[model samples]
Target: MLPEEGVNAVRVVVGMLVRGEYEELETLTEARRLTAAEIAAAVRRHGRDLISPPDEAFRELGGVAVPREQADERAFHVDFPLWTAQDGLSDLTLGLTVAEVMDGVWTVELDGVHAP
Candidate 1:
């Protein structure tokens, strides 16, 4: 779950998760790409502790499949707004470890979300 991988997963899930709410055109513009620095900055600005070290936890989870037995559990949960230049805003739940393994078991819950 490097930033790229996490973002990719989020994009896929978000698209599937929120398909009818927004048009295809709107969704494309909402796919935001965030750098590691940008992620760190947001965490700092929100006064939230880094759930796991920057790049460390995600790097470990990348390509490592979680066991099916614990697929329902979530290893990490992120509470933050996902920023995009065009569509403006969104929120994301970046599932790490077990949650990622289940593929679609965990649902992203966003409040006052303008876009998926």
Candidate 2:
């Protein structure tokens, strides 16, 4: 099972992914402010299952390392499989700040990419 925090993080990630608003850094940053508890509650309210444990649901979700110019911060990169989306690849790349992963949200810019 995914930790509550991880579950929460995935919730916002999935929501943004579904909305197609995840391509902008500013939008993602705003979405990242949502709390894990908030995400969990939203998931329950929305009746959606977006993430599972590392060995389970997320096994297909690939993770990559993100390097930050600042020495005090560490970032992570993630890519959701093509199956996660209704159409097209909703691959996601996330950058987390010092704030707990459950609380912080980072944004990426998707330029010149059009959704079908």
Candidate 3:
């Protein structure tokens, strides 16, 4: 579920978030993109670990499709709801900016992780 594979990229990124896999998370960030890095940094700063959250936390992996203008067909947004029950860190939706690089192929990148 690599971020390069946009289909299940959200789930992979969420897993990385819970497991504190900084390097792996960094790899998923879009090249030269600072937003993703900042989000990762904020999550790390909190030092919250759920250990093993319930399966329900990941039930919303596909995310909500966001409408885009005709000229912006190459890229679009999807907000994936990520549930959590841990103290301090509650549930949040991961905002993903997906880009259709070439034809059917797409790349998923973290736009932001925030409370919904």
Ranking by TM-score: 3, 2, 1
Per-residue C-alpha lDDT of model 1 across residues 17-85, encoded as one tens digit per residue:
233223332343342343334433433444322222233323333433334456464433333333333
Off by over 4 Å in 1: 1-4, 21-74, 80-87, 90-98, 102-116
Clashes (backbone N, CA, C under 3 Å), per candidate, total 0, 1, 0
Q: After aligning candidate 3 to the native by TM-score, how far in Å is the CA of 104 from where it should be? A: 5.2
lDDT of 1: 0.35
Comparison by TM-score, 1 against 2, better one: 2
RMSD in angstroms between candidate 2 and the native structure over all alpha carbons: 10.0
lDDT by residue for model 3 over 36-65, one digit each (tens)?
458667666544543444655445434444
User: Can you write out model 2's per-residue Cα lDDT over 1-116, one digit (the tens) per residue?
Assistant: 32344435545554454454433433555545544344334334433333322334444443344566756543444333322223233332232332233234433322221223
Best by lDDT: 3
The reply for model 3, stretches above 4 Å from the true place, is 1-5, 35-37, 45-47, 50-74, 85-89
Score every model by TM-score.
0.26, 0.37, 0.57
